[model samples]
Target: MTNFSGEVAALAAACLWAVASIVYGKLGARIPPLQLNLIKGIIAIAFFVFTILVTGELFPSITILPMCLILLSGVIGISLGDTAFFTTINTLGPRRALLMQTLTSPISAILGLIFLQEKLNTLAGCGILLTILGVAWVVSERTTDIGHISTAEFRRGIVFGLLTAAAGAVGAVLSRSAIANTQISPLWAALLRLSAGILILLVWASFRQQSTFRLSSLRNSKVIAGTLFAAFCGTYLGIWLQQTAIKFTSVGIASTLLQTSPIFVIPFAIWMGEKVSIRAILGVVISIAGIALLFYL
Candidate 1:
């Protein structure tokens, strides 16, 4: 149990990320993807400061190497990874894109084992297999006439989501690596990541020639609601819980549980009046199995 502290923190991070997914998911329903990402980061930045003030342990001594690592993780995970995911959700719907979590745990494990030289024994391998199989079960559509989405389009969305998950896994490992080397403070590291994510999007918006970002959009009621939730979950709560978990546990376990965003998204999707399918059910089951194996196996 003592050694499980890290695992416990990972679980907490997963739950928080799950909630953030819900927040951003709903926000996407109402707004453009760029606006959603932009405001989400802005809101998160505010709460991050609040968190620093509230927690006395917020200020850690800063250094260069760890800061660079965490910032890179942010670029990979928050910027590129999330951009792919949101696009997938828009293209494939949350039910389908979320199912991609099934692959993330195994990918993270393999990456960590390769790059970080973390252990990946038989049980871990078995856990990875079961989890993937379960996720496949959850999202596998049976009907030939499932309406609208052609097979090609469906596959495209899955591919995008998987890419997002893969990149995200790499980011998680990198963040963990930085934390392991106590050369930099986690707060500054997190700040770098958040700021970097925001900047990346800033450049993207400029590149795409998006019209002036509107204060009116920011003032929208739903955007405000979503922003608050985003701040709480993604910026303050999510990162805080994530660092705590990673600092305490293996990067593999932390990624495993955080990928459970799909699991939480399922019920939330239903509650939001989206149609639930048998395929989606199977995907959730697979993801849960994967998570269980990640911990218990």
Candidate 2:
């Protein structure tokens, strides 16, 4: 019974991420991706520090090997992957970007097999395939009002999206390996990775001369509230749960479960008064069935 805890946590993390997406979608329009990333990382890290202090868990001893792996995971996964993802969204639009992002599941599965030698049972594999298919189906349904985008931009966006997915897969695998090899708490592991990622992004932004630390938006009460709420739900709690999932389950299963964020977003869309298509509803149903298969079978 307790063994399923990780999967349940992963599913809950997906739901949190889904809700956070609404806030972030608006914020993304107002803030540069790098700046937003840095701000959220800082906020989440603050929360992590406060939690650690309150809990009084002796700071876990960190080993050089796990530290390096976790640092690399942050650099590749959060820094590079998230930058690419934001660029893809800007260039290709969210639907197209998300369609490519769906590749993360299989990429993680293959990497887990090759690197971690993690094999899924027959039912779990089927569930993963079905879940990915369902997500792709829902995400592919785009609105008819897309503005014009150049061919070169489209190509560039696709490339960035693919890189983002690949980076995410590799990052998950590295984090899984780190956690498997170390005694670090998931909260601490998440903090380390996020700190590394934000530092890398800061350095890269400075090197590229694209650094713009905009604090003007924080003056807006609404923006401040939204940013804080989103950071708490998406970055702080979300990454903690993600680390927890990877610690307890196979990387392949954890990645698959996390990718179900879109399914959770369906209910959010309905709550926001967005028209839900029948196809989207059917896709959600299929995805739910797939999730059940992963657990019950």
Q: TM-score for each prediction?
A: 0.82, 0.82
lDDT of 1 by residue, 67-178 (tens): 7888889888787777777766765666566677557668877777887797877877887887777666755664332347777877777787888779778787678778
Best by TM-score: 2
In the range 197-229, model 2's lDDT, one tens digit per residue, is 999988877877654777787789999999899
Model 2 off-target regions past 4 Å?
Answer: 1-3, 88-100, 112-140, 145-157, 250-252, 281-297
C-alpha lDDT (0 to 100) for residue 121 of candidate 1: 71
